[model samples]
Target: MSNINDKIRQIAKETEPELIHIRRELHQYPELGIDLPKTHEIISRELHKIPGLKIREHAAGGYGLIAELKGKKEHGKNVLLRADIDALPLEEKMESTYKSRHDGRMHACGHDGHATWLIGAAKILAQLTDEFGGCIRFAFQPGEEVGLGADTMIEEDKVLEDPKMDMAFAAHGWPSVESGKIGIVRRYAFGCVGDFKVRIIGKKGHASWPEQTIDPIAAANEIYQHIPAILTRTISGTEPKIMSVTYMQAGDVNVRNIIPQDCVFGGTMRAVKREVLEKMKTELEKEIKGICQVYGTSYQADIRIHGGSVKNAPELLNGVKKSVADVLGKENVYIIEEDNLGGENFAEYSCRVPAVYMFIGIKPEEKEAIPGLHSPEYQFDDTVLAGAAAAFANIAIHGCMGELKEN
Candidate 1:
């Protein structure tokens, strides 16, 4: 075990420079959505450089790629390591040399680092095929920013079957923890995501008239105010839920003297549990309808479930914790007790197999204030990529060697 750890560390160290280079290159040419031809080209070229990896590509649903490394010792069963390859539709704010070259497109969520780490781990695992058994499937997914990556990959590519996965693993960079640290949680690592759109219909009239019109704006305001208060009374305080009204439109911007007949609004809701999330959705729809009724208005709604919460399998987590601690000392590893409301498409894979989604700390040492993920100013220290690479390699070997219980 110690010898394998030493080899993993050595290879990670040797590949650290290349990992950083690849991350920077990816950052420079950030692409949005699933049709990332250039990003696919770059990733495929790198994967081909590693010997004995069977590569598969998907272009219909998304720019998905899966590279399989057949083990020398074991042949049938497999393990999956996934990385998101899509970026956000925001412009880069950082003035770094590797800043996004594509206008209004950025890899602000650390996916650039995630993709590079998987590539580095794939190289190490591919080289030392004799060390462990079972196949290692490295999945580079697309459309994660808008949240269709994992489902599309699974449906279009059938990623979980054929060589069927025994266990799976993935990681993301986190700024809340200090750089180079690893955070693991046994349950509810990420929240379920739900997107909702509400349209309030009312009669339009002149601004001077008070009782002559049914104002949808008034109903929307009431719905907005009651949403938070109602959730506080209904949802348990222990469970963290976030409901945000991200977009709203009422009347024409140029005309202020008249009330528009329609008021349209949309937002996102997140909860740590699937049942709790569904409850939130039901409550929200009911509340909106009730408010519209009072205002003598009609309302329509569209509430769609994006992704479910991610829970790490307890038995697999124990083995993964030992592996991570073996690779990056126990002091650098942390067991997170609190659940994060952030949504991850990796939840799709975690729900399918005994999976571990780790958080790699990437906060810069010199900065007192760390930038949040998905923000235009978000950035992280590139040095954590090596440790991340080594830790993932450790999990791929150690996690598959042990017997895992199905979820």
Candidate 2:
């Protein structure tokens, strides 16, 4: 165990420079959503550099790549490590030389780092095929920002098929924790996320005469105002849930004297529990219908309920605790007691196999705190790459050896 651990650390240290270079290169030419041709090319070129690995490209479209590394021992359980390769639609705000050249697109969520770390692990696992057993599947996924990547890959690419993964894992960079640390939480790590858009159709007329036409704008306002109260009353205070109206469109900019005929608004609904989420949806629909009825307006809603909360299977949870503690040191590993409100398509993958997703700390100094995920100012130190890659490599090696057992 100690010899393999030492080798893992050494390989991670040696790969730090290359990993940083790849991450910076990825940051400069950031791609958005599942339509990442250039990004796919770059990833394919790098993965091809490693020896003794079989690589497969997405036959349909988009930037989905799967690499399989076969160990010396056959018939061993296959494990998968996933990394999202899509960037956000935000423009880079940091003053780095590697800032995104493409405007309105940035790797603000540390996905670039995440992808690089997995590559580092791939290099290590490829070299240690003799010592380790089982197959390692590296899933470089796309469209994670919009929560469509995992489902598409699973359905179209048949990612979980072929070798049939026995276990899977992924990691995300967190700015709240101190640098060089990691966080592992049991059970629900992320909330269930769903999107909704409401379109209200009303009679358009002169703004001066409010009584002449039905006002969709008034109806939207009423519905928006009722959301907070309804959520508070329906879900318990201890439970975490949110319903925010992020995008609103009603009137035209050129015309101010007349009311617009259409009011379109959309937002997200997130909850830690499925029952609470269902209740919120039902109550919200009723409220919207009632408000539109009173205002004599017609409304239409498009709602999509995605994967639910990401729950770590009991076996994987305890095994990963030991693996992470072994690699990052017990003191640097902490157990998170609270649920993160963010959504992850990793939930979809977890439902099929035993899975665990942990966080890597990338926070800079305390006095000069960095921005959080999805924010324009968000970025992480490149040095954290070595530790993160080491942790992942350690898990893949030890988990396959059946060393990651419950105490």
Output the number of the lDDT-best candidate. Answer: 1
Count of steric clashes across candidates, in order:
0, 0
Task: Report the error of model 2 at residue 384, Å.
Answer: 1.0
TM-score of 2: 0.92
- Highest-TM-score candidate: 1
Give the alpha carbon lDDT tens digit for every residue of 106-183 in model 1: 998988899999999998898788977888889999888877778867766888878788888998898887887899
lDDT (0 to 1) per candidate: 0.86, 0.84
Give the residue spans of candidate 1 off by over 4 A. Answer: 59-62, 74-77, 403-407
Error of 2 at 401 (Å): 2.0
**CA shift at 381, candidate 2, in angstroms?**
1.6
What's model 2's lDDT at 154?
A: 81
